[model samples]
Structure formats: C-alpha cells, structure tokens
Target: MIMSHPDSIPLNQVLPIFLQVLPLKEDYEESTAVYGCICNLVLSSNSHILSFVPQLVSVFAQVAVSPVESHEVKVHIGRAFSHLISIYGHQIQPLLGNLSPAHANALAAIAP
Candidate 1:
C-alpha cells in the first residue's frame, strides 16, 4: 500500500482547526487568512480535502454571502469557490443543491 506523506497532516486533524476558527465572528482577518490557506491546501492536495468538502464548501459559501464580512473576505471566498470548482467540478455538484439561497447566489456569481 502506498503511504501518504508524513508531513501532510491528516484531514481529520486539520479540519477541526478550520471548523473551530472559520465560524468565529471576532476574527475576520485571521479567519480570512485561514480560509485562503485552506483553499491553497485544497488546490495542492485535493484528495486530502475530499472528506471535508461539504464543510469546506459551506463555510466558504457562508463567508461569501455574509453581509457583515468585509468585501475583501467575500472576494477571497469567491476566488476560493472558483478554484475549487475548477479543480473539483463534479465533486461539488451534489452539494450545491443543499446550499442556502444566499450561498447559492454567491456561488452563482462566480460559476463558469
């Protein structure tokens, strides 16, 4: 059996940190940076991100649609969503139906 790289932390470990931090209202800057990092990680190692796709999509959608979030954060979320779709278009299809209207709209704005 082929082993994944030792330096690549398991999704189980990395996801919890994202789940904890992404929803906080008090740290927009930190959360946005974390969101960008997560997107980059997903782009670089999509297989590792597969199990957490639903949560990842939802968190980004939420951020993208949030009126209180800064424009910069929303733009980052939109870019992240675009990157994800470019890499994993089919994988994200089923989850799109489950998104809230605002989330769907946000995604639609960037859809190809």
Candidate 2:
C-alpha cells in the first residue's frame, strides 16, 4: 500500500525507521518486509529516495555481510541494488568499494 503511493509518502521520516529493521535482526518477517518495501521504493519513480541512497547502500552492505540473514532477504536486497545500479550507474561503485571485501563482493555478485 505504501509503495503504491510512494510519491505521497514522506521518505525522510519513514526510510530511517525501515533502515533500522536490518540491524535489529529481531524479526525475520519484519526484515523481509522492509526489504520488500525497499525494493519497491527503489523501483518507484520517487526521486526523493535518491537522497537516501548512500544510507541505503550502507545498510545493504550490512545485510549482505550479515551471517544470519536469509537468502530470500539477500535476494530482495540484490534486486534493490540492481535497481539502484541501473539508475545511478558508476556513482554506486565508489560506495561499494568502501565496504569490506566480502560484503562488496557479495553485493557486486548480486547485482548485474
């Protein structure tokens, strides 16, 4: 429902809350749901989220290297990364480099 009307939503307030979900690692369903929302939000034509891409990349790196995360969740994250790369192209490469080798490789491997 939120993704369906991404343009109307205030990204700044909601996105941070969603970003918190991955680190907490308390609820699998919640984590996956957050990833799903992210995947949808990235694909949506909401330019506002572009400002949050760095933050999103940081969190995605965290998730990519998270030992306990499910493959399904990583798949969702991969799709989000792919969408970001499609939109931002080379701009994303630098951020990926700042990550740990394994994390960077994991994310790179996931994206096209």
Q: Which RMSD values do the candidates have, in order?
A: 4.9, 2.0
What's each prediction's TM-score?
A: 0.73, 0.83
Model 2 misplaced stretches (Cα beyond 4 Å): 20-22
All candidates' lDDT scores? 0.68, 0.77
Best by TM-score: 2
TM-score of 2: 0.83
Per-residue lDDT of candidate 2, residues 27-65 (tens digit)? 765777677777777777466666788878888878888
Give the range where candidate 2 is weakest over 10 consecutive residues by summed lDDT. 20-29
Q: Model 1: clashing residue pairs?
A: none
How well is each residue in 8-27 modelled by candidate 1, as lDDT tens digits? 66666766665766655776
